[model samples]
Target: MEAHRIFFERPFDYKYAREYSGTLMTPTLWITAAYVILVFGTKAYMKDRKPFDLRRPLQLWNLGLALYSGAAFLIATKEILSTWFNKGLTATYTDINSFYEGTCGAWAYLFMISKYYELGDTAFLVLRKRPLLLMHWLHHLTTLNLVLAGYHYDTHLYSWLLWMNTFIHTLMYSYYLLASCGYRLPAGFAKKITTMQIIQFCIGLSILAHIGVLKLFTDREVHCNWRMWWGTVFMEILYLTLFSHFYYVSYIKDGGKKFVRDQNEKKQVKAQ
Candidate 1:
């Protein structure tokens, strides 16, 4: 199949200057550098300043996340629609790759840069004197790195993962935004969002597993870069572990009753 042939043939243009040019490496380097400088600088400045005002920055962050989620939804919907109508995964992959090669590629790069923007979420926590959770920082840093690596390797599964995450982040960030605005959604709904993230990771793992199976079992010409495959697998495993831990800490541990009681008490204090 032509689709299988394209998959087997390395998608990268081998000309070093050409392929690596317009890739994520240069921009990611610059963004990561800027983020480090900005975050540390802001942290230092906040040491002598009044408590960080959560209202303004949180509003801005919410808006940014909403826009990003919207974009992801569009991309994912397009891919799913194409796949449904075309009657096969191969065609869907090819069409999506073409989109990536053209416009989606640039958008992905922009999203990679946005990871640096997201570091401000932590800066906000620091300024507000909120305790920084290890999972939060790990997610931010590793997610940025994953985006960089995904682009560098041009992993075929990346498009699918991106599509799913965009959908998930749309919900997750929207919730954060709303909660920051002092709107209390149902606790169960919030928990479900985290659950959805865990599921997303699971789905991503499945895609990687499917690709591995294809390579192992069949004479199919499907080819995947080993680095990309393992990078994705490792990252997904890390995410699963972290998110699962978060779920346990937030909901399941201590019978979850204590957790809810504490949350309600906090809410009452906030209201008072």
Candidate 2:
């Protein structure tokens, strides 16, 4: 019992978190609108100015997020394992208590709210004059929308999303943290991260399918709330398609040509 308490400590009011999620839905939409405008506005404002050298601040920002994601992953892992062992595999997805109770609940709420803070990633790109891809902003927007809807509807299926996202982000932000600090990471590192993101979306859809099967064939009460289910399905399919196209264009097609050309130039220089 003492050992269990260590892993399942409830430090926050879960009911209040749910209430807050419901109340914040409209405000979140408003904030997202403001975010879109600000992103384009910042880009226009910076068009005539030299890019700000924000390396140090960017390093600190990535470091902070890396740490947060790492910690969230650990907490989520413990909660997931505990539920799986004690309640069974189905409980991991169907248990609303798992979503709104104990340490996991608190961390999940933090994870949902973190979406708002993550808009800063785009701000960094805009201010630094980096090429902002559609995938980047669309990802932020869709994700914020999905998580808020999931929380408001108590979509327990999102427990899987919360866990998987935190795990991927732990790696993703750490990569950013290293690259920001002047580390010469492998050329394929970013490509590999994008590949992993593509894989993540595929796995998410697979989990949704698994829940769908259970709902259709079994009498077991599945919490596959349709309110968020269709939205989740649409977003996951869209992400998978977008990320796959990005990988093909950036790595397998144009990027492959660029890499080979750069390599040949290096070899010619060495030979001379």
Candidate 3:
């Protein structure tokens, strides 16, 4: 409880964020660097070795992520709506304290922190020697940076984007939970998950685009943190293109073809 008070209960202060002075930013940088080094180093080290059986661990990891994402989604939704109903929809995003200082604030902070744990999904693949996609880690790294930047800036965009992202993660991690256990989820479910992600990015991009237009069209300057605003928009575009390509190659052109295996093993290896 004391720890929570110190870490979670405290609201973000833009004064502290003036120069990236926070618990999350430096650690995010160091960890991401380490993640890159270890990914390559471990791959070379494991080239000649047999793949370790990580079925049970994978199951546990995915299940844990699924549960956490679901909880975060619910908490953020309830608090945001409460703020909207009690305060007003217009102020819900515009007012920093209304969006960031309370239960809703705690969950928003948690949502940023949760991206670090999601990085573990890539780690598990590295350890298990699964075929890794470069976009996976790049997306993770860029997201961590953007989320921290967005949160530190205390922009309305982060609040909306975080809520949407939490919902997507709930579905994504649940799908991973089933896949980790080797259960054959409905065919093409992975494709659908990617499609959902694409849609979220599209919506997110639109929101950011509108912000840009406001910055341009309005005579009075819009009070946005330009640092994160442009970074977020760039990343959204990059991911939108990358995910669309991944979907095309994985689902459309390939016709959603998955790995093949024997009947019993099929349930254990190929799903998502």
Candidate 4:
């Protein structure tokens, strides 16, 4: 029990002790800027060039990410469950006013840092000359910002976000791994993945919306930062809209129609 508690504890006590708090947002901003440059620069360089055959590297990357996300999900679930069972900890953890006091704040910090690594997914896309849809990069950029801010602000809501996102990515990267390896699961498998992502956005939005209702309409004090809450709402709404568009374009508009058109073309070729 003692070993488990220590292992689950946040691993950054030195940063807290040294009070190098400015280190958080400073690097986050710099990295975000550099990421933008690198992405577009790569895109320009790849213009009119053959796409890299990154099938093997991509498969390895996806497999690694799937495992990493799975580990994060399990660790976070354990931390939450452990904290919830202790009476004193549970009260503070569940209290609206004391959200910043989660025992898992260190893990939240780790989650924020992991977002930087997640940028590699975009790097792979750019290298392969794959489409960088608005939904893809925007989601990455906005999520990095949100997680960075959430940690600095000690927004307790991010605990749930961390868990949900890690869980979704577990499934998502697994699908990516299989797809990259030239394996197709079923007819509607891809659509089902997008639908799951859309549902994730819905659940995230509802949590923030529930807080809004309590603060504005009800008599609750709702101790979280309203600014952060509004920021979350904006991010969630954008994600929901962009992902819905991607789904429409993929499964409904392009996917099904393209299949029919391909079949027609094949039939005409046969007749000729």
TM-score, candidate number 1:
0.79
Report the alpha-carbon TM-score of model 4 versus the true structure. 0.78
Considering TM-score, where higher is better, how would the candidates rank from best to worst? 2, 3, 1, 4
Backbone collisions counted per model: 0, 0, 1, 0
For model 4, the superposed segments whose C-alpha errors exceed 4 Å read 1-22, 81-106, 216-223, 258-272
Residue lDDT tens for model 3, 1-272: 13344353246533343234256678879988998898889888888997788888888887887787788788778867886888765444445465565566666767777887788877777777877887798898888878876777677777777777878888887887776665667765666788889998998887777777767776534446677778888999999998998877666664545322223355455543
Question: Evaluated with TM-score, which candidate comes out highest?
Answer: 2
lDDT of each: 0.69, 0.80, 0.72, 0.70
Of 1 and 2, the candidate ahead on lDDT is 2
Cα lDDT of model 4 by residue, 1-272, tens digit: 13233235565352352133335567777888898899999999999898787889999999988997898788777766655665333222224222233444454555776798898999888987766877888788778987777665646667667878888889889988987776745656667778888898898787787777767777744445888888988998998899888777656785567535544553554355
**TM-score of each model, paired residue for residue:** 0.79, 0.88, 0.84, 0.78
Cα lDDT of model 2 by residue, 1-272, tens digit: 12233235456666566666787788888998998999999999999998888889999999888898999889888877888989887788776576557666777888888999999999899998877889899999889978987876777877878888888888889988887776756777777788888888988898788788877788878766765777889999999988888777767896487556644563554355
| Candidate scoring better on TM-score of 2 and 3 | 2
Give me the displacement of residue 25 in model 3, in angstroms: 2.3
Residue pairs clashing, model 3: 182-267
Model 3: residues >4 Å from true position, as ranges? 1-5, 8-23, 83-96, 219-223, 254-272
